[model samples]
Target chain A: MKKLLNDPADLVAESLRGVERAHPELRVDHEHRIVYRADAPVSGKVGLLSGGGSGHEPAHAGFVGPGMLDAVCAGEVFTSPVPDQMAEATKNIDGGAGVLHLVWNYTGDVMNFDMAAELAGAETDTEVAAVVINDDVAVEDSLFTAGRRGTGAAVPVEKITGAAAEQGRSLSELADLARRVNDNTRSMGMALTSCTVPAKGTPTFDLPEDEIEIGIGIHGEPGRRRVPLAPAREIAEMLMEPLLADLDFTGGDGVLVFVNSMGATPMLELHLMYAEIAAILDNAGVVPVRSLVGPYVTSLDMAGCSVTLTRFDDELLRLWDAPVAALGLRWGM
Target chain B: MKKLLNDPADLVAESLRGVERAHPELRVDHEHRIVYRADAPVSGKVGLLSGGGSGHEPAHAGFVGPGMLDAVCAGEVFTSPVPDQMAEATKNIDGGAGVLHLVWNYTGDVMNFDMAAELAGAETDTEVAAVVINDDVAVEDSLFTAGRRGTGAAVPVEKITGAAAEQGRSLSELADLARRVNDNTRSMGMALTSCTVPAKGTPTFDLPEDEIEIGIGIHGEPGRRRVPLAPAREIAEMLMEPLLADLDFTGGDGVLVFVNSMGATPMLELHLMYAEIAAILDNAGVVPVRSLVGPYVTSLDMAGCSVTLTRFDDELLRLWDAPVAALGLRWGM
Candidate 1:
């Protein structure tokens, strides 16, 4: 409950106010809780819209900029945004090329984005297509998801697909590319501690001091199991086993290895974990052509880390390397 | 401690190994524990060397890259790096134009870096100038410092001076510019809970559940006082009042407002806190020309944040805006 917030109800709105001020390149629709690039609707460029709960920050809202998302509809912490917010954002960011919805594979998010796409299509002449990402290999079904929970892969998916969109790709092409990125990407998460929602003012679940939850979902969903705390080396194995099994990441153009912090995990530990994961990859003959290590997508204050691997082709690699100016992920610009 | 580490003794080295693996742009010397730009000794550019204890990550080591730092010496967790490491880094990065040692104001760090500068001076033909940063306005003298603790201002000092160095500023000129940047910057941190060092396996200090330590140091040193936890608005006032009182951030080319998380504070909370801080700045007529909100400087897993305001002139502003590709801070490149 020791959070830097005024009221739980005002968290998302107030934070958006700060985002608006901190990044002048972004314009926040405070009323609808939509964050859009200041120069959104870039003529013939397809609009890229993605969103989910607010707690997983730098995900939906922070990714809004020139090379990434055109707009993002932010919901309350750990809750899906209403369809109205998404529909409004879609209409606003849509250019002549059309709009693409990057929906993370959560039941609530998928349903809402679907409804939003329908609403946008009915209300405006905007062509909308949705690509649902389910890259988390941690669980087949979880508390908030029917299939695999989309976790860290959203970062690479958004980056690669957004880069393609910036190149004036058609909406269908962008959707296909997003799906291809998701198909090649796999993620697994484990938590050292549960995060406390500001509204609840308590940890979502109780984890013993000496235990950790493996294969955990972003919103404290029950994972594969709890186990006694182990070293980071073992933890990396537990995470990598499922990821490598779920996806063939050995060949092609190698892989983009991402070691993400689930909020409270420091960069030092993330780097350490990356070394462990890299060592494992080396043993498995998996070459990591590119690597990202940091807290790009995160749960609120959960002290944990996640591993994501995307087996990339030359095209996906090129798109990943393209310039991106989003607050969440920025490089090559 | 619930840290994702194998052995506390090997934490720094293991993390550095991961750093080396993750960022191919930077080269890490495992023996000396120095992280240097892959292209160190950049012909004639003055070498920018900064280092401190570990734990306050993305500080010295993460800043090693183009338009930032030439090299960084890393110490053990919350422990000062030895003179040998600093001396070795100095010799390697010196490009005949000379080397500048950026020392945070902790006693151990300043003494060690001063010794390293002397060692480099006596051992090699490399000219070295030192700039000691003591930007924390929390106290006149605290636990590990004589004047002010170099808290969050190392980022701006390194950035501005690093940019100047990249522009071919001489060692002495870079030293002067770094000192100027440090003088104009002021920072104050607060902690809601104490952080646990991996070796220590316990909280650094005892902080009750309902209270927070204002003006807290990054290393969990005693702050001004412990007060009952207040709303983010009041907390912002508590942090800003002292910063504003110590210096007039109202005029000039405005200020560079940086709100840094101490580690565990989530981006959602950080953004909300930024809103509170921005409103206070607006009321005080402190026009923030630039703002960086995130966990750039951190204290392991402590749950809190710090605010830094660097009163900028045109030159400093230009330097701050320069492209930096460091892993810790990257933009406009």
Candidate 2:
């Protein structure tokens, strides 16, 4: 395994140091590896927190700012953050109102955040609410493998709900908003190349260069199946078929499409994929109300892309239309 | 030169079509790859517009929601959005309010956004104010090249200033706030491995396994220099010394730090770096008010990280505390 650091063990700690040095407006609890917006406990405002394993960029941490998450606990690369880390972030960011945890549906993430919530509850009066985002349409939502792995849609839920919270909405309202956003959305991704976790120092899987993995998870987990690389048109169908079948957009209220590139895919290819994907959605009698292309939520250096659809109702549309000013997504503010 | 793409030239166009189809709420002008929030020309609010090259995920487009940007134009991967694209986006998103073009400090982005602003002025009463974010402190302010490239700090500027605009602040006030955020920020980055642009289908540069490139740009551009792989502690020094020399954070209010992953750097490493970086800042007597460490702005798949610092005053801090909802960065709302 070729890398540029002194030791593999020091990777996470060292990266956190670099982050602290770079963004002074944020406070990094070095021991906890929690990224928090400097001004915490915005008196009277509820705290919003989210986290998961490392490897996904701008997620969790980058989303920590005003109108989004107050704190984000980052675990080791592709590993969930510890309970202590999440507890620290919660205690630090929780205003008098309470603290809400919006976590993705991963075994480690779910278990760890749950532990943190308990710790936070035991430690303080910061009312804690947990909302797990399970919007990925890839995995069958059965009592198996911690349900569907949360992919791209967690970002929008965090942003929208974070904004609602920022508007001084009650904790219950914020939790409801988060659930609504999660309910309205669904996502699925495919990987063209397996990613090499720096810690593991090896590709997660072995597939020939010409083959692509369908329905892959964000952490380089095996997808539903591996298939030969095909034309862009066919590839778009392969991605959208399951996604379309999983949800019904026939009511025609319009849908928000996010064509997200995994780390290595370029916008050029993303756009091509978008074109073909658009044709499919058009044929499905779905009106595209909001469209987001390019990479928002991403996995490490894996060459692939995910398609996310959020069926927007009037209320959801209003929230989507409402101005937001977070780090990753901002518009009309 | 290994990549999975059909045709290089069709990259941008195809991706835009896909984005358009996926997002029914966003209108995509195929003739010019510009995307606007479906509810654009946001009534009675100053129009905020931002765009640049395509590769920076969740950037300009991902930022197009309420209180952030009104419109975003997409260029080819790692290339600036063209004048026509920006002009159309500006026009469509403008609601008779003056338009503000907040862009990163790249030559192509500056030139193209400038052209779009000029066209925008000729067509309508919409006054266009442009501000380029050049926060990277690595490059000395000289006549040769564009001074310093904007890095992670751009995210906060959009959020904070977008909130100000959302509150019906005058265009000049919004511009001033943006300038303050720009002036108070600095960033420097290093790359461990050169990334391959999808269209180019080749590595951006050659680096031996033992080497690391410092002061690199987001597009996998060559850094200021390359050196043998070293300990994270030493790398922290390499990235921080130049930044410290660029500004005097001594006896200041505080600073905000952002440790940005250049796409492929794992999260574990990011946190490890953050611990060391926090120590360095503490030793420098600079109180770090806040810090954000993660991959917010990214290159396609470069394995490296960047450091960004923004000196914070009370007012700017208050604005930073505002809530925002967007795809990439969400908090404080």
Candidate 3:
């Protein structure tokens, strides 16, 4: 694979330099591998911090801004940021109010953020709250692996919960909101091709050109089943079937839909899938109140899309309507 | 290419449906292919709108939010959004305060945004100001291509301009600010691997595992030259030498450095590259005011990195310090 990188070893550090350089208001604590808004210690506001593997752009770091995450700890590609990085980030961004840790379902992210919170609570007066988003419906509740991968649900969870924090909600309130959003949201993704990590320089999996992997995880994990490329309607059914079975989108006022690209899927196709998914929902008597189609969250250039449904109530909608400023997911100034 | 999409035609619509479902605060006009903040036409504010190809997640569209874009027009992957989309986005977001069209240097983006502005002007009292960001220092000024490709410059442009817009700066002033940022900024990228567009599920360009392409454009376009993968320091020199020559970073009070990942590059390597880039700028007598490293604007999951520098004035710094809330770029509150 021909690439445009200086060196595999230098890729991560160089990218961080670029981020810090572009947004001077956002400080890159290179020593700690954490990113924070330059205006640190945003007095009297509960600081929200998150971190995860580096490949997911705009997930943890891109989300650092007002009304969103206060800091983002970045690890190597596909690896969670270390505890030290998270600890420093939490400390740097923590205001007198408190701190909330929102992370995805990945084991690395969960464990690392937990460690950082522990370290943070021991050292500072900052109270801490943590929420893990496990919204993927692809993985059933099983004992073998962590059940359900967190996919598109993380985007809205962060956006809405971040807004709650910005509104000066109590730490418990923010944590509750995060937990509720996580509980209501369910996501399932499919992959057409495996993406190559820069260091690996090869496809992550051997997917035949004519086949597709259903229920693929964000980290290039194998899906529940590999199937031939099907029509949009059928594929939507395949994705939605599991999600519908997992949750009752029918007994609610409506559900929010997120058609997320797995990095490489274009908006043209994403919208097409959206049309079909909407039809499927309509057929199933599921009213759609809100929708998000795009690569809000992604796997590196993987040719796939994930469907996330979050059944929302009035409070969730109000929180969702709150203004947020981040690198992705923003509205209501 | 085994893509997980149901049908190639359904891709975009499905994705947009997901976007709409996921983000309740953003209004998605699937037919028009425009995404707008639900509270657009902000009563009295310059409507800031920008967009382009789809694969660059968190760009153009991901940037729509408070303190940033009022709306975003998403095009097909690697292709500029159509003029109609931009026109609709402009009209939908226009609040009788006029509009500012911030576009990148791609021929398609420039032409389409211009057409949209013209169309928008014909129907409404929406005075439109256009500014094109041509910050990539990869290509020397040439007649053959649209100046230097706007690489990492879009982030700062959107950010500073968004701040100006939030401050209630008029359309013309926002345009001027964008132009000033463009003038002061320069970027150069190197790719370690060619990225595969989702529709075309193969490497855009074949590259041996050890080879890298320097002076690359954002959209998987052929770069100025291909070279063997080198040490981070040497690669930093290779990218920065051309950028420094194009613009004198020396004696500048301080410089903002952006080490952006195209995608697929890890954060670990980005920091190392940042250190190397800092050394290069230091040798050139460029004091670093700030640094950013991440995959802000990306080309699918392309494995590459770009370095961008902006010589900042106090005004620029203040604007940079102003609060911004968007899905893609956010900073001071």
Comparing to the true complex, what docking class would candidate 3 get? acceptable
| Residue-by-residue lDDT tens digits, candidate 3, A80-152 | 7888888887887778888888877787777888888899888876678888888877765432237666668
Model 1 residue runs over 4 Å out of place are none
A65, model 3: CA deviation in Å? 7.1
lDDT of 1 by residue, B211-259 (tens): 9999999899999999999999999999999999999988799999999
Interface RMSD of each: 0.8, 4.6, 5.3
Candidate 3 reaches a DockQ of: 0.26
**Per-prediction TM-score to the true structure, in the order listed:** 0.99, 0.71, 0.74
Compared with the true structure, what per-residue lDDT tens digits does model 1 show for residues A1-333? 899999889999999999998999999999999999999989999999999999987777778887889999999999999999999999999888999999998999999999998999999989999998898887888899999999888898988988998888998899999999999999999999999998999999999999999999999999998999999999999999988888778779999999988999999899999999999999999998899988888999999999999998999999999999988788877
Q: Which stretches of candidate 2 lie over 4 Å from their true place?
A: A1-6, A10-188, A217-221, A242-278, A285-300, A307-333, B1-6, B18-27, B37-49, B82-103, B108-129, B140-144, B156-161, B164-177, B266-269, B323-326
The digit string of per-residue lDDT tens for model 3 on B16-44 reads: 66566555667888887788978998978
Q: Residue B20 in candidate 2 has what lDDT?
A: 57
Candidate 2: lDDT of B138? 64
Evaluation by TM-score, superior candidate among 1 and 2: 1
For candidate 3, what is the lDDT?
0.77
Docking class of 2: acceptable
lDDT, candidate 1, at A328: 78
